[model samples]
Target: MKARILFVCLGNICRSPMAEAVMRHQVEQAGLNDRIEIDSAGTGDWHLGHPPHEGTRKLLDEHQISYQGMKARLVAESDFETFDYIVCMDTKNLRDVRELLKNAGTLESRAKVFTFMELLPDKGIADVPDPYYDGNFPFVYELVNSGCRELLKRVQADLKLA
Candidate 1:
């Protein structure tokens, strides 16, 4: 079976979706798209059914990354078991993921939950700041793009595809 990844943030209309696009791009470039799956979700329902934020779209467009048909959706307990890794944007998304897992009686999630910045061990950054509020979409994309590169490295190693 293919390994699955899920990127998560508070609203899914910004950071998470961007990360998804970035990571998917890398995976495709590696010719692993058929062996891996990527998706994204929000910790809450604030932007459910909405397309990614304009700021996010702009940054992605600048890079020619496609986020076609992506819609914001809330994270669910099922996701804990569906994805191999649940990559969150910040601490809050991690907390929300934990809460969801616990509520489902799965105290420890089957999926490995990691903060996106955790992949950038040497970058000294700890969170993928929300561009939705700060309007620093470029900065967020920079971080996510960097992390996604490292994340793809780790995934390839984990899947013994290196």
Candidate 2:
């Protein structure tokens, strides 16, 4: 089975989608596109069906990463069963995801949920700040890029991929 991964954030138009694109790029580069699946969603439905924020699109374009066909969507109960890893952007997102899972009685899901920063504990950062509010798309891209690189390493090890 393919190793399925999901990136989550509050709006899905900024951080999570950015992570999604970056992770997808790395996965393709590693030739693991056929072995793994990647997607992203938001904890809220405010931006449902909307494309990623302009900052996210601009930065991704600058990096030559493709965020094509990625529309904002809310996290669904089915995601717990579909994804092997659900990575959140911050503590609040993590909490919301866990609460949703608990409320839906799917807390026993096989998926391992965690914050993106958990993959790099040495970074000393707990959250990937929202570029939508701060307009610091460049900094956010750097964080997402670094986190996605580390995440790919973890996924490869977990899946025993070379």
The candidate that wins on TM-score is: 2
What lDDT score goes with residue 83 in model 1? 95
lDDT string, candidate 1, 27-80, tens digits: 988999998899999988888999999998998999999999999999987898
The numbered model that scores best in lDDT is 2
Query: Cα lDDT of model 2 overall?
Result: 0.93
Error (Å) of candidate 1 at residue 1 is: 3.4
Q: Which parts of model 2 are misplaced by more than 4 Å? A: none
Model 1 segments beyond 4 Å from truth?
none
TM-score of 2: 0.97
Candidate 2 RMSD to the correct structure: 0.8
How many clashes would you count in candidate 1? 0
lDDT of 2 by residue, 1-162 (tens): 589999999989999999999999999999889998999999998999999999999999998999999999999999999999999999999999999999998568778999998987888999988888889999989888988889888888888875
